[model samples]
Target chain A: MWLRLNLRHRIYAILTALVIITISGGLVMVWYTYRMERLFSGIIGRDLVGFQVAAALEASLVHQKGFVSYYYLDGDPEWLRRLGEYRQIFKERLREAEILSDTPRQQEILESIRSEYNEYIQIKDRVIDYYKTGQRKALADVHPQLRELFFHIVDQCEVYKHIFTDQIQEARAEAHDQAEQLRYVAGAAILLELLLALFLAFVLVSHILGPVRRLTLAAEGGEGPGRIDNEITALSRSVRGLIQDAGQVHLELERSREHLLQSEKMALVGKLAAGTAHSIRNPLTSVKMRLFSLGRSLVLSDTQKEDFEVISQEIRHIDTIVQNFLEFSRPPKLQFQEISPSTVVDMALQLLSHRLDAYDATVTLQRSNPLPTISGDPEQLKEVLVNLIVNACEAMGRGGAIVIREETAVLPRVGKAAVIHLSDNGPGMSEAVAAKAVQPFFTTKDEGTGLGLSIALRILEEHEGTLNIQSAEGEGATFTIALPVKGADT
Target chain B: MKTGFDILITDHNPHVRRFIAREMTAAGYRVQEAECGADVLFQVSGNKAVDLLILDPDLPDIDSAVLLQRLRKRTPALPVVIHAFSSDMEDHPEYLKSDRFVEKRGASIEHLKEVIQDLLIRR
Candidate 1:
């Protein structure tokens, strides 16, 4: 079930677990350290208090005796033994205090205790001396001084006890404060980790899961545009581009297949044309010879002569049509040269001027200023223009103006190519026809071989040029040709 | 109009060989026909005074362009006419270059006759 969750949720869960473990471990360590510190502080406080009480009791005994000979003069072994026991206990307490002292302040306080303790011992020795020598006058004279010295020793012991107790209390307070801080920090850390985990989960859901879901929905052909998240936006864009490129590739492949099919069809036509022309030409040659011979032998009537002339003319027209068909079916061997587009257009216009005049149609020429020359077959380009112009003239029929314009505009946004648009106001083709205009042997004309546009398209393709067609039913058609401008060879 | 030179036409297709022979004969020139590259080579090597060699690029026994090269080596001055199936002769001019290039389809008989006559006269 956990593995089934998304990555974001999983990450959040893992981090939350880590934070809880870390905070709990830290709190546990702090609690343990506090307990140990309190324990040591209690032992130090008890030892210092015991030492102070023992010092006070010994001082009171010395003060009541007026001198150190009170116990020795009375010969009280019990007091002496009690004092020895207290001294031994004090020595043990001092050793324990030294063990507890970790700082310089605590060490200084211990050193003071040692020095005051030694001074008390020296006073006790003096009292013992007075008792041993039987010096009553000396004991009476030093009585007040001894009392003062004992009180001073008691004061020092009290001060040492007070200092240790204060230290123990301060350490306990600090440990309590630290433990409280750790608790607060752990609580805050756990809370923040929870919030962060929740935030991360939300982000993952929206940025990753949301986009993926939308993509799936889109793939399923759901309605409306898919909603994409920020994290997937880049990937989506790239995928969109890849899809577009694939579409273009598919289109190009389709076009190439169509071209191959057209070429195959043209090859078949060429074979047929070759055979038909071969058979027809011999018979036609014989017919022409026979007609010539018959015309010379007979003094024929004017009508007969005129009939023969018409027959010959009709034969010539048939021959021309067959020849054109053969040429259209056959592929052309291109002669490439650097030629200006204007020159090709002008040549085409010149060839078609008479037809245009007969139709009462005027031809207009609009050329790019200082048109750049392109590397292509000039004769082929002219043939393409001638075909287009002648077709336009035929469409206009009685009379219509044909607008021939050329421009060298940079189409960098589309691709690095120079574009030329040729628009005409002649009768435009239907969408269906326009789509298949470049297909071989597909023509609307009664006598059309239907290879003109196909050949032109092939030539343009050979020159690495694109032929774009735009047409409406009555608004006329525009043909835009885009070719890459040549740069210096590397 | 008859010319002394005899033109030999070699092609895998019988129709193309016959067409070329007929056109050449019509133009008043003697004609010989070879169905394959081997037959062409055999005829040329057997002391047949062949003035022009009209061959298709793809033949049965040998590659037409290579045969042309071999023929050129044998008879350097023989004007060869290449009849290509496709229009992309310009792309492979180095290999397909002959005295004249004639497309198998849509070529005028007059054009072929005129070119052959020019070559013979020049020779």
Candidate 2:
């Protein structure tokens, strides 16, 4: 379920869980704290107050006894005043004790304490009166009873004191028990919250950060193979695909950059050729005319006529070079037509059969009975094929087999196209020569015009095709011309 | 046919102009030379006896097409021939007005002479 949800929904659900846990935990803590505070105040305030009141009543009763004893022994009037003061204090204490009683047994204990305390106060007064009238014997006889009454008051007060002390102890024990229970509940709640938070953190880190880290690793080209996590592996795969796409785009850009530079270089060559042709062609015309005039006017030996013929021939050669230069600089318009690619190849092969026989070279062709028809200029395409075949034949001066094949091929970005493969088992070209083979005026052969491949390349370009050469030293050379299949683009 | 009728040959190159003039002289026609368009206009308007004009389209002083247009207005009845650097000139009105268009190096001097004789015979 978590995997099915996208990142946004998962985050929302997790955060909501965290919020609820936090709020409920806070409420539990607050409620527990309030209960604990009330328990704490009850234990300290009420229990301690009961203990203090019982202690005060015991001290007052003891003081009254001491005052009566002093008056019997020394008969001082100050003892009488002290005894009255203690008696007033004992009454005040008894009144406070009565008000503090809550339970029925505690109320009964307070009533017995009130009665015993009043009897003690009455016995102390009788002793005080006997002391004041100078009845020493009577006071002596009352002193023992006063002593018994004081002890009785002490006993009841001790009972009342025990009750307050017992209450204080019980309240403390109960408060401790409640506090212990609250500690367990609060501790459990806190532990649950902590566990929940840790779980949430684990989920958040593993789900969110793990995939992101894997994605980063993939982007950095550092992802290891055989990833286990489904989500992270998928993210890594996507990143890898993106990288591959970027790499393909980069390769295409590099190809276009090289193509553009080649075009610019060709443009420069055209301008230079045009200027040079213009300057030299006019002079060549004059030379031809002058040579003809000399031939017509001079009466000379065979040697002189031969020399004039040689001169005319050399002049014609220069004229041919100039004409070829102009032609390269300014290409003739293509006469486009729809023709069978194989038919054109066959026509060029048939034209070259006589030449192949002369070179003692054998030729072979793939049986393409009815190849797809493509739009092209048959004459120009034939010229391109013938040039390539002648080049192959020349490379194999010692004689070799020439093979031509055709197929439907698919190119990168550009779709299906027609391909003609012409392979020659001859002396293969070096990498340097292969690199610059199609550049104008670059030739390796002694008598080559150096414009054949360049011209062929130009013609193929007009048909939106390319000449691809593959060669290595001591191996064979293969030239593949890839032309677009159907909708022709000039 | 007249034996020594005068003809004008105009070209920037001295060799081509002189060569053609020599070829026409051998054919028994009086040949005059002009180096520039102004010279052709000057010689044509000055000499009423000039029988023909052979013009090269590339000239030093003036555009050959402009010169031809101006010269045609001045000498309407004179037969004109264009010696071109390229063969395809069916598109130009000025060139089509000429009685003959021969590509300079494309045609032999013998072919140019044959054209000259044919045009003079017609005249």
What is the iRMS for every candidate structure?
8.9, 2.3
DockQ of each: 0.06, 0.32
**What is the TM-score of each candidate's chain B when compared with the real chain B?**
0.83, 0.85
Writing each residue's lDDT as its tens digit, candidate 2 over B1-123 gives 457778899888887787788778878889899998888889988936598888876788887667778877988998888876762343475565655876787346777777877887877
Model 1: residues with Cα > 4 Å off, grouped in runs: A1-338, A358-360, A412-419, A462-464, A484-490, B1-33, B47-59, B73-123
- Candidate 2: TM-score? 0.64
Docking class for model 1 is incorrect
- The alpha-carbon lDDT assigned to residue A230 of candidate 1 equals 48
- Candidate 1 chain A minimal-lDDT segment of 10 residues: A60-69
Judge candidate 1 at residue A271 and give its lDDT.
82
Worst 10 residues of 1 chain B by lDDT: B83-92
Q: After the best TM-score superposition of candidate 2, give how far the Cα of residue A422 lies from its true spot, in angstroms.
A: 3.5
lDDT of 1 by residue, A65-136 (tens): 432344655776566666666677667766766765566865776677677667767766666667677777
Docking category of candidate 2? acceptable
